[model samples]
Target: MTGTPDAPVADVRPVVRRHHGDEFIDDYEWLRDVEDPDVLALLEAENGYTEARTAHLADLRETIFGEIKARTRETDLSVPVRHGDWWYFSRTVEGLSYAIRSRCPATPGDWTPPAVEAGIEAPGEHVLLDSNVLAEGHEFFALGAFSLTDDDTLLAYSTDLTGDERYTIRFKDLRTGEELADEIPGTSGGATWSAGGTHVFYSTVDDAWRPHRVWRHRLGTPVADDVLVHEETDERFFTGIGRTQSEKFLVIGASSKITSESRLLPADDPEGEFRVVLPRSTGVEYSVEHAVVGGDDVLLLLHNDGAPDFELVAVDLEPVLTSPLASARDGRVVVAADPGMRLEDVDVFARHLFVSYRRAALTRLGVLDIEATGFGPMREVPFEEELFSCGLGANAEWDQPLIRIGVGSFVTPSSVLDLDPDTFETHLRKQAEVLGGYDPADYVQHRTWATAEDGTLVPVSVVARADTPQDGTAPALLYGYGAYEISIDPGMSVARLSLLDRGFVFAVAHVRGGGEMGRAWYDDGKMAQKRNSFTDFVAAAHHLVAEGWTSHERLVAEGGSAGGLLMGAVANLAPDAFRGVLAAVPFVDALTTILDPSMPLTVIEWDEWGDPLHDADVYAYMKSYSPYENVQERPYPAILAVTSLQDTRVSVVEPAKWVARIRATTTGDAPILLKTEMHAGHGGVSGRYDSWRERAFELAWIIDTAAGAPASTS
Candidate 1:
C-alpha cells in the first residue's frame, strides 16, 4: 500500500450494487471495514502519503498555528448568566484544553452578568464540572448534557468518550461535591427535570443513531426500573424532550424533516400520560411554546401550516391539546408570515417574545411585547454592521428582564450583549479578547452578488485585508454549505486571520438549500433542485474571477459534511474552476447511502434528499449528480478529503472510497489525498489545540496548492 505520491494506489475489491434497475460497481467498497487490518493498513498508507506530500509546508503549518494561538486569549471567562440564585459561567485556564464550569452567589436585583477580569477566577466560585479532568485519559471527550435541578443542588451531566453520539449521564451533588449513584447510560445528550426535581426525562437513540424513545428516570431508582414514557416507532421522525419556557409542561417532540408532532406532559404530574398537541400533517411544520396571554394558558405556535415561510400564531391550549383534529390554523395569527423574511426561531419570555429571522442574507432579531391587546409591533434589534450575524444567546430563565445575544462579523470578534426588552438598549457584557493586536479597520468585509445560470442573484460574503488589491492575482478561498436550510453566517474566527495576513481572500457563497435568502431560497436548492446549490457555487467562483477577486489558478474551494457534498459535486461539475478542493467528512456516496435505510440517519434525511430507495425518478435524479457515480476521466483540481473513523453521520468509507475512485480516474498529476482521524467523530478532534492543529494543516495545504507548488515526495 505504501507508494509514491504520484502513483499511490488502493487495492480494488469491486462490490456491485443494484437499485431501481440501475447497476453500479464500487471498486473501493472494501474500505468500509474499519476493523479489517488491511483496511487499516490502507488508511495508514494514505495518511503517510498525505504527510509525505505536504512535508515541505511544515514551517507554514506551524506559523499558522502559532498565529492562531497568539491571537486568541488563552485564559478567559465567558459572560456569567444568572440562573435562579447562582451566577453560572465557564472559564478557560491558559494551558488547559477545556473549560471549567463554575458559579457564585448572585447579588440581589443584579440581572447583568457579573464583572470578572481575565485570568482571575471569580470569588467564592463553586467548580461544578472540570472538562479537562474528565477528558484527561480519553482520546476524545464531549460534554453533552449539563442540566441543573430547579433547586440548584444537583447537577446532571452526560459525556461521550468515544466520539460516538451515545452518552453516559451521571449526577453530582453540588453542595457536598459527591457523585450520585444514579448513573444512566446510552442517552441522547439531553435531560429535562420535573418541577419537583424527583424525576427526569431523557431520550435514547436507536441503532441507526436516531433519538427514538424518551424515558423517565426517578431519583435513586435502578436503571432497569426507568419507565418508557414515549416511543416514536417511525424511523423518519426523531424524538427529543424538553421543558417549555413557562416551566409548566414537559414537551416530547417527534419530527421528520418537513412535519412535526409534539406531546405535552404537565411538569407537576410526573406520572401522567403525554398528550399530543396536534396530529402530524404531511407537509406542515410547527413548534410550540407555553405562554400566559390575557391570564389564559395559550400556546405560541410557529408554524408553516399555510404560509410557506412561517407565521407565529396563538392557539388556545385547552382545545389544541384535547382535540386530535384541531389545527394551529384555528388560532389567531400574531406575526403573519412575510414573503421576504424567513422566521428561523422564536424564544418566549414572560413579558416578551424574541423572534429570529433572516432577510437580505443577514440575521436579525425582533422583540415583541406580549400585552393584553394581543401582541405589540415587533421592534428590530439594531446592529450597526453592514454584514454580520446576530442571534439570541443563552437565556435559560423564562422571566429574565434582559435577553442575551451574540453578535459578530468576519472582521469583528464576537461580543456578548444584554438587551433590555422594554427600552431596546443593549449593554455590552464582554467582547472577545484577542491577545495579539487586532484592528477591525485593517480588514474589509462586504457582500457581493453573482448571477446564477437561471439569472437568480446569489449572495456572496467576502473578507480580505483592507489594502489587498483585487487584481485577480491573490489566492482566494471560497467556502459554501447549502443543505438542511442551515445558514453559514458570517462569524468571527481568529484562525482566519492567518490567511488574511498572508494575502489570501476568504469568501462564503450563500447558495440555495440554505436559509440565507429565505425559505424559498432553500426550497429552490433542495430535493430535485439540489443541483442548483453546486451550480450556484460555481457561478460565485466565476463571479469572483470576473470581478478581479481571484483567478482560477489561485482559487481554492472548501466545504464540510453536506457542504463536502457540495465540494465533490463542484469538483465534478467544473473541475477547472479551482486550483484545489478540501472536503471534510464529505457525503460523497449519496446514492448508496440514501438507498440503504439501515445507514445512520438515512431515513430521517429522506425529506431533504428525496426517497431514492423506492422511487425510480429519485434514484435516477440522484444517480445523475452523485459525485462517486458521476466521476469522469478528466483533469481535476488538487483534492484533499478528510474524514473520521468514528463518524456515524457521513460514514468514513464514503470519503475513502471517493478519494480512491478520484485518484484512479483523474488524468491530472495533482495530488488526491485522504486523511482519516482514527479517534474522532463527525466533528473532527475534540480538544481546542487538536482542532487548531488540524485546521492549520488544512490551511497550509490550501495555501500551498493555490500557490501552484509541486507536490512534495518522500
Candidate 2:
C-alpha cells in the first residue's frame, strides 16, 4: 500500500425526496444498490485509499492486536450454572473462533456452580453444541436461540450465516447425538419449548424485519403444519415468545417503544388460545413475571403507568387474567418508582424476587424475600467500586437457593458471584483470567460531570493509566452512545489497554439520550430535543479539555450506530472540537431514512426519532441537525467511517454517502475515509480474533491521527 492514492469520486445521480412540503436532493443515493459493480468498485477504492493512508501504522496495529491477544485467556471455561439435573457452561479452545457449549451431570440439590480450574475441563462433560464446528466454513456466523427441553433430551438452536438478522432453526436429539428431521427457516432467533417438551414456539419477522408472528410446532410435525398462534399487526410493535420462570406459562409479548401487550397460555396446553394479560395502551409499557406468593399464584407487573421511571406492582394471577386492565390498575404497589432510581427489570424466584435498577448512573440490584410474613424488606446488594457495572446473571431455576450476579468495571475483569438470599453472603464463582500479567493498581477510573447546554449535568466515565499526566497534553478517545434509553456502562476491555498503555485517556460521555441518568434523561434527548444528544457530547469533549485531561488537538471522538449519528452531527455542529472522528456503521442519513416508512426499521424508529414524513415540525427539527443535510464548507476533522456491506439495521449506504458528500463539501484537506466490510453485519465480524484485529486497525488510525499526521494529498 502506497502512502498516496487518488480519492474515488462517486457518480452523482440526484434523487429528489419530498416530505412535509420540503424537498431534499440525495446526490449519491444510487449507492444503496449493493449489487452494482460501480458501487462495489467505489467501496473497494476507498478501502485501498484507507490502507495506503494507514500503511505507516501497520506495525503499531499488529502490536496492539498482539497485546489484546496476550491479555486474553485463549483457552478458558465459564462458571458452570446448574439447571435441573445438569451443570451447563461454555468453553473456548486456543485456536477456535467460537465457544463449545457443554454440560455435566449435577449431584441433585447442588445449587452452587461446579468448581473447575482455569485450564481443566469439568468431569463427565458432554458437548451439546460446538459453535466452532458449526462456524468452520462460514465467513460470518452468529449462534442464536440456544434452548433445551425440560427433559434435557432435545436441543433447539438457531444460526445466522449472513449479516442479515434472519436465522434458521434446527433441532437435535441429545440422547441420540443426531439432528432431528424438523427444520424451520427464517425465524427471529428465539424459541421457547412447552413444559412437556412436546411443542416449540418461535417468532418470525415480517417484510420490515419486525418480529410480528409467533408459531407453534409440535415435535415430529412437518413445517407446513405449524400453527400461527399470534400476530401483531401494528407496524410499530414487535413480538416475541418466552416461558415464565415457573415453566407454567408460555408468554407471547407484543411491544413498541412506549406500549406493550402480553398474552399467556398454559405451557401444558400448547394448542390452547393465549389470553391477554394486559391490553396495549399508548405510552404505557409494562412487563409481567409469574410467582406463587402466600400459596396463591401472583403476577408481578413492572410498568411506567403513573411513574415515568417505572414502578413494581403485584396482582392476583386469576384476576389479572380475567380483567387485566382493571386488575393492573387495582394492583398493590410493590416498589414505587423513586426519582433517583429507575426500575429496569424484576426476576421472580420461588422464594425471592430480584430487582435490577439504575441509580446515579450506576447499576444496583435489590432482593425481596418471600416468607411466612408476606414479604421482607428489599435488601440492596452491595459492591465496593464507586464506578462499575453490576446486574443479575443466569439464575434459571425457580427453586434455586442462590442468585447469580455479574460485576465488572473499567479496570476490573468481570467476576461472577453466587449470593445466598438467606445469609446475604456472596461466593465468588469466577473472575475472568487476564493471562498476560494485568494489574488493576496500574490504572485509574473515575467519573466527571459535564454541564449540557440546557444546564443538565451529564456524567462521563474516564479511565487512564495511573502515570498518565493530567496536564492536558495526552491524547484522548471520547466515546458516546445516547439513544434508545440505553446506558453505556463502564466495563473492562482487554483491547482498550492498548490505548491506555500508549498514554491515551478513554472517556465515555453519558449524554442525555442515554438511560444512565434515568428515563427523564432519555426523554430530554429524543424527538424535538434530539440535538441535546449531539450538544451534550460536545459538552463532554469541552469538559474533558477544560479539566486538563486532554485538548482538542489530541482528542478523537468515537461512537457507533446512533452514536455514529452523533459523530456525524458533532462534526457538522462543532467541526473543530476534535482532532479526528471514528464512526462505525453510522446512521448519518437520518432524515432520508426516517422519511421512508417503506425502509426496514424506519417505522419502528418513529417513536425515537418521530415521524418525519408526516409531521412538518418533526421533519424540520430533524432536518436542522440531520448530519448529511447540515454538512457545511468548513475545515472538519479527519474522519474514518467504518461500515459493513451486509448491515441491516443501518444500511452501509449511509456512511458511504456521508463520506462522499463530506469529501465533496468540506474545505479541509483532512482525509475522509470509508472502510466497508464486505461480509459482516452491524456488530462487524463474528469471531473474537477477527474483531480484535478490526479494533486494532481503528485504534491505530486514531493514535496516528492524534499524533498530527495529515492526509497525504500528493
Candidate 3:
C-alpha cells in the first residue's frame, strides 16, 4: 500500500494560479454556514468523548506494539535494559541477541555491558527478562535516561510512554525493582534527588494541567501529600523540575511555552520554602528560558536579554539558594563543569554537577567553583557533533560519581565513555559494531532574508547544495512553524537528505511568532499581527522567485500544527504562490480553534491563541481569516493536508473537515488530499524508520507536485 502521488508541476503551471480577491465573490456559490456553536459546546462537556479517545489510544498503542514486535521477532535483539543505578535505558549488542544495558556506574569509561564477562555475580540483563512491559502498564516506568542512588536502593525515572506533553514520575528500589512511590500529580514529571537522598523534588502540572509548582516526595512514602517547595499562582508564571547536585531545582518561567521564561527557583530544602535563584519578576528585563543547577552558588542559565544569540551566564548559587532545589529528575541532579563534555544526547556531567539545559540545542558540562572562580568564561567541550548523541546520568551508582558519557558519531557506532572532572580523563568502555551504511556531510546550510508585503523582513535558513544549479528551477520545499514564540533554528535532519539527494532545496522560513529574530519579532508575529507570518512566508517564496533560486512555480510551502495554520493562511490568501501546500495536524480554523477551548487543548492554549469564544470581538477577528470557513471557490494550488485520527492535540476532524470543505469549494480540480495517521498523536508516527519513511511520503508528494515529477506510488 504505497501513498498517493502528487500532481505534476508541469501540469500545474500555465494553469493561471493567482490570489483570489473579493472580485470573485459573485463567481461561485458561497459556503453555507452550518456550524453550530451549541453543538461544539456539548461535544466538549461530554465526558464520553474523553473515554472514547482514551480507548482509541490504547487500541492504537497495542496495534503499533504488536506490529513492531511481530516484525522484529526472532531478530535476536536484546530486551531493553533499565539501569536503575544511573537512570538510563540501554541495549547492548553482542553477536546476535543484542544485550541491553542501563544504569551505568559513575566510574569513568568503566561501564560494563550486561554480560557474564563483567565477572560479577549480580542481577543483569541475562537475569532479568525484558518483561518490564509484559505486565499491565507501569504508569511510573519512565523511558530514556534516568538515575539511582549510591546503594541502588532508590530509583528515579520518567515515563512518556504516551507523549501527552507530560511524563509521570516513578520512584523504585533496585533491590526489588518494584515501584516504591508513584505520583501523576496532574502535571508533567520533573524529579530531582535531594542531598540527603531521602526525598525527591519534582515539577508537574497543576490541577488544570497548567504548569504551577515543584513538589517533594520521600523515597518510600506514599505518593499523597507531596510538599510544595515553590508554587507560582500567576497564570503566566510556570514552573518545572530540573537537576541540582542533590535535589531538583524549580525551573520557573513566564510561560511553559518553549523559549519562554524569566526566572528560576533552586530550593535546597525540598520540604522547605524555596529561595528564588533567578528572579521570576525580572519581568521584561530578561527572557529566561531553561536552566541548570550546579554546586553552592553556581547555576547555568540560558537567556536572551534582547540579544541575537542566546548568551550563557553562570550565576552563583549560594546567593540564589535562598530556597532549596525544588525541581526533580532522578534521585540526584548532577551539575556540570565548563570544560566537561556531553556524549551527544541530553546529558551533562563534569567535576561536581551534572547539568541539563532544556531549551537550547547545544549543551555543555562545566566544573563548579563557588567564589574563587569568576565564571572562568563558559568554554565549549569538544565532542563529535555529527556521529554521537551525548547525555548525563543523575542519581547514578555513586554519591559524587563522574558523568557517564555515551559518544559515537555516524561513522562510529555508539560508544560509552566515562568523563572524570577532577582528573580530566575520558575512559572508553564498549563500542557497538560498525555495521556501516550511512555517512554525514551529504548536507549543507545557507541563510538569507526576504521582505514581506508590509515591508517586514523575514529571515530564511536553507539547507541544500553547495553546488546548486543556476538553472533557477531546483524544486524547493520551504517549511516554517511560526506561531507561539517557537524558534525554528538551523537543525540537522537525516531524512532531509532524501530530498537533497534528489536535488530538492530545503528551506526554513524564520517568520514572526518565532523568536528567531528576538522578542520584538515574536511579539510582532503573534495575535492580531499574525497576518505578518503568513505574508512573511509568501514573501520568502516571492523572494526565492525574484532571486532566481527557485520560481514561484517551483516553490512549495509546508508547515505543521500552528505552523500549519500559517501555511494554510498563506495558501488561502495566495493560491498561486506555491505549487503545493503540505500541512500536518494544522489548526486551520484559528478563530474557531481558540473559541472551542474545550476541544482538546482549547482551554489550555488560550494564552497562545486568544480565546474567540470569550469575546465577540475575538470571534469577529477569527472569522476575518478562518481558513476552513474561508475556503471559497477558486483555482487554488494542489495541497496535501495531513492529520492523525489519534491526535488529541489537534483532532483529525479539523483537517478532515477542512479537506472536505476545500474539495467541495475549489473552482479548479486541484486535488485536496487528506492523510491521517490512525496510530499517532500530535506527533505523527513512532519509531525512527517510520518517521523517515513518512517524511519520504511527504517529499515524494511535494516533488511530484512542485517539480512536476511522476506522482508517488499511490
Candidate 4:
C-alpha cells in the first residue's frame, strides 16, 4: 500500500434484484445514475483517485488544517438568546464563511445575558440576516427557516443553495429594514409564525425527499395563493410545522419510523381548521408539549405508549382544543416509565418544565414546577462532568426568567448556562473560547464497559491526552452510530483537537442501535435485532483490544449515516479489527438502498430498517448485514469512503458503490479510498473554512492510518 493511487474501477452493470426468492445480482447498480456521464465520470475518477492517494498526506493535511485553525476562537459570539423585545445572536467574522445574524434591544426587566464583546457591535445591533451575505455565490450554503413573530415584527428565513435539502422561503420586514414580497419556492427548511404575524406555516419535500406538504404562507402572499396546511400521504409519514411555546398553538407534525401524529390550530386561528391530537397507533410514539396547568390548558405527552423507556403524559388541552378527535390516551402520568430513564422531550417553561432525559448513558436535564397540582417535583439539573452533555439551550422566552443550559464534555468546551427556574440557580453563560492556549485540565474523560456477545453491557465513551496511554501504546479513535435512535452524545470537538494533541485515543461506541441505554437499547439494535448493531460494534472493537486501550494494531474505525452502516458492517465484521475505516455519508448500499421504495429515505427507513421490501424474514435479515451485500474475498481495513454528489441523504451511489466493491473485493493490500463531494450535500463542505478543510482531510487520513500500524501481532 505504499503511495498507492491506481483504484477507480467500478463500472459493472449486472442489475437483477429479485426479492425473497432472492436472485440479487447488482454489480455497482450503475452507480445509480447520478446524472450519468458515466456517473459523472465515475465521481470524477473517484475524486482524482482521492487526490492521488492522499499525496502523502499533503503536509499532514496542512498540519491538521493549521491545528484546526489554531484552536478556533476566530471572532466568535453567540450567547444572546432572549427573543421578544429582542436579543438573539450569532456572530463569527474573522474571515467569515457565514454567520452574522443579529438583534439587540431587550432590557425591559434585564434577565442578564448582555456581555456581547467579540468583534464588538451590540448597542442596538439589528443586522438580522447576514449568513456572510447569504453565503455569497453559494457552493453550498444552509440556514433553512429562522422564524420570528410574537411581535418581533416578522422575519421568516430559509435558504439552501444546494446541499439538496431543498429550501427557499424569504420575508423580512423587521419593521422597515425591508425585503418581504413573500417568496416561498420548494421549502421544508421549516417555518411557523401566525400569532398575527400574518400566517406562515411551511414544509414541502415529496419526490421521496419526504416532508410532504404543510403550506399556509399569506403575509401579502401569491405563491399561487398558498394554503395547503397538511398532506403527509404516508410514504411512511414525515411532515412538520411548529409554534406553541404558549404563543398558543400551531403544531401540525406527522412522523413515521415508529408512528406518530398531531394537528392542532389557533395560534390566533390562522383561518382555523387543524384538530387531531392523537389518532396514530402502530407502535405508537408521541411528542407534543404546550402547558398551563393551574388555569388548566396542558398537553406535555412524550409517549412510547406502553413505555419501553418513554412516558410523560398529562393531556387535556381543553379536550384537545375542544374535541375534534381528542385522543392522547386519557393523560395523567407526567413522567413514569424509567427503565433507567430515556424520556427525551418536553420544554414548556412559563414557570418551568424543561426535562430532556437519557440518564446513565448521559445527556440529562430536568426542571418541572408549573404546579397548581400537576408538575412540581422533577428538578435534577446538576453537572460537574462525569462524561457530560446537558440540554435545552436557547430558551426563547415563554416568560424566560433564566434556563438556557447547553453544557458539554469529552473534556468540555461547549458551555452556556443560565438555569434559575426559581432558584436552582446556576449562571455561567458562555464557555467556548479554546484558542491555542487551550486546557481542559489537559483532557481525560471516562466510562468503560463493552461485554455484548448477547449479554450486552456496551457503553464505552473514553477521550484521551491526560498524557495519553492506558497501557497499549495509544492510537485509538473507535466511534460508531448504531442507527436511528441516534444518540452519539458526549460532545466537544474543536476538530477533535487534532486528535487529542496527537497521541489520539478518542472512543464512543455505546452501541446497540443507539438511543444510548434505553427504549430497550433502541429495541435491541433495530429490526430482527440488526445483528445487534454488528455484534455491538464487534464487541466494542474487542473491548478496545482487551482493555489495553488500543492495539488491534492501533485501531481506527469510525462512522456516519447509520454510522456509515457501522463502518460497513465492521469492515465485513472485524477484518482483523482495525487500522483505518472512516465512512462518512455511508449507508453502504444496504440491500440496494433498502430494496428501493424509490429510495430517498426509503419509506421512512421502514421503522428503522426492516420491511426489506415486504419481509421474507426482512429479506433474509437484510441479506445478512448488507454492507454492499457483504463485500467479501477477505482482508480490508484502510478505507475512507466520504461522499456527497448532492446527497439527498446517502446516495453518492452508496459510497460510489462501496469504493467499487472494496477495490474489487479486497483480499489484502488494504488501500480502499473514494471521497466525492462535487459541490457537496448531506452536510459535507458547507464552509466553516470548508468545514475545517473537511476536518483536515479526515484528520490526515486518521493520522496516516494510525501511524501506519503493524506491530503487536499479538
| Candidate 4 lDDT by residue in tens digits, 82-164 | 88787889888888888888889988989897888889888989887998778787788999888888889888899888888
Model 2: clashing residue pairs?
A: none
| Alpha-carbon deviation at 535 in model 2, angstroms | 0.6
Question: Candidate 2 at residue 712, lDDT?
Answer: 24
Question: How good is model 1 by TM-score?
Answer: 0.98
C-alpha lDDT of residue 198 in model 2: 93
lDDT of 3 by residue, 117-186 (tens): 3323334322222324421242212243254553456667665554355666666666676765465544
C-alpha RMSD in Å of predicted model 1 compared with the true structure: 2.4
TM per prediction = 0.98, 0.98, 0.67, 0.32
Model 2 lDDT tens row, 126-200: 889999889878899999999999888999999999879889999999888899999999998998999889999
Score residue 505 of candidate 4 by CA lDDT.
Answer: 81
Residue 440's C-alpha lDDT in candidate 3?
A: 37
Error of 4 at 424 (Å): 4.9
All candidates' lDDT scores?
0.90, 0.89, 0.53, 0.83
Candidate 3: worst-modelled 10 consecutive residues by lDDT = 8-17
lDDT of 1 by residue, 1-714 (tens): 245455458898888998878889889888888899988888888898899888878988988888888888888888998888899999888888898999999987779777876677677888899999999989999999999888899899999998888899999999999999999999989988998889988999998999999999998999999999999898999999998877889999999989999888789899998888888998999888888777788888889988888999987787655665377787788888999789888888889988999999999999889897678899998889999999999887888889999999999999999999899888999889777778999999989999999999999999998987899987899999999999989987888887887788899999999989888899999999999999999999999999999999999999999999999999999999999999999999998899999989999999999999989999999998989998999999999999999998999889988999998999998899999999999999998899899999998998898875322210
